[model samples]
Target: MDATPSAHAAALWVGLHLILLLVLSVLVVRQRRKHQVVLGDADIPELTQAVRAFGNATEYVPAGLVAVAVLAVAGAQPIVVHAVGLVLFAGRVAHAIGLSRSGGSSILRSAGATATWVAYILGAVALLFYAIP
Candidate 1:
């Protein structure tokens, strides 16, 4: 474990994102608790769909970051990795905020989704270039 600020920041980035995921989980649970959507009820459709969509959004952040941390550990360019990580973190937070609302332009959500996918691709490229050789 290298004793560098970037290394610590990378870990922090992961940890904070995990916290966001948990927060989203809580939100879903709270909604369920309040609405008490019973099994197979007609009115449950929207709530269930929202839950699924939230889950779909939540699914990307962690899976996208696994290779990133490995690349960071393998000594890939810390600045690029850190920048991507921080950007992804910020993007996810903004995305969750916007999605929780009933209506808004989807620019934030699109930006966040794009950031997540781009970070994953960039991390994969970094791993291939740095970790393979």
Candidate 2:
């Protein structure tokens, strides 16, 4: 089925997120192999952060994609869709870098968290304003 142009915008975001997920997965795998941890993080902070970064992406990326779908279905502009995608991608990357550095506190972590939350809120509001009758 050929997607409409707006759907293509959504697809672009989806594809980008998928690539991000794959990268995060590789990071986790490398962390595990390096540390030789079988199941869990084995109390290693870097491994813990790697796992959590990937885990966190699993939690948020799908929801963001859903929002993108809604926006496309609702006839949102492609630029809006791209904006959402860019923010989500950048947020995850930032968060991963920050978390990979430390399990606790970091400016990148905080900024990434903020960007991620903003993307979520934007998506939600876009649904409300664009889709809801």
Candidate 3:
């Protein structure tokens, strides 16, 4: 295995997610301004939803990105890395859209959450496989 990490695939995915997160942040900011919410959702439901959607992405995306990057650096197969990345990105977008619209019982939200978990689990397994001697 090459000691130097080849992170081209990982970098692409990370860059895409970063942009997604930034767009989510902008959405939240726009909601806040539109609703005149100064801080902490301001008891506005839409604002609250937007904040949580953004927060959820922040909570989930970094760890996913790290896992993908580590796998890339450790020389995991490119297909596996891309698969995980695509699933994670789709999940985040779905979750954001679902949660932004309705607070409860959304197919998109459920699928998104499931996909995110699957990506994380698969990433961990891949990492463990590479790390084990």
Highest lDDT, which number? 3
How good is model 2 by TM-score? 0.92
Q: List the residue pairs that clash in candidate 3.
A: none
Predictions ranked by TM-score, top down? 3, 2, 1
User: How far is 100's C-alpha from truth in model 1 (Å)?
Assistant: 1.9
State the lDDT of candidate 1 residue by residue for 1-133, as single tens digits.
4466656757877888788787777767766777875433236544554564467556878665776577667776677668768777777776666566533457766776677767777777777888566
Better of 1 and 3 by lDDT: 3
lDDT of 1 at 81: 69
Task: Give the lDDT ranking, best first.
Answer: 3, 2, 1
Worst 10 residues of 2 by lDDT: 124-133
Kindly list the per-residue Cα lDDT of model 2 for residues 20-128, writing each as its tens digit: 8999899999989999998999998888998999998898889888888888988998988877777877888898889888888899988888888888888888878
lDDT of 3 at 50: 91
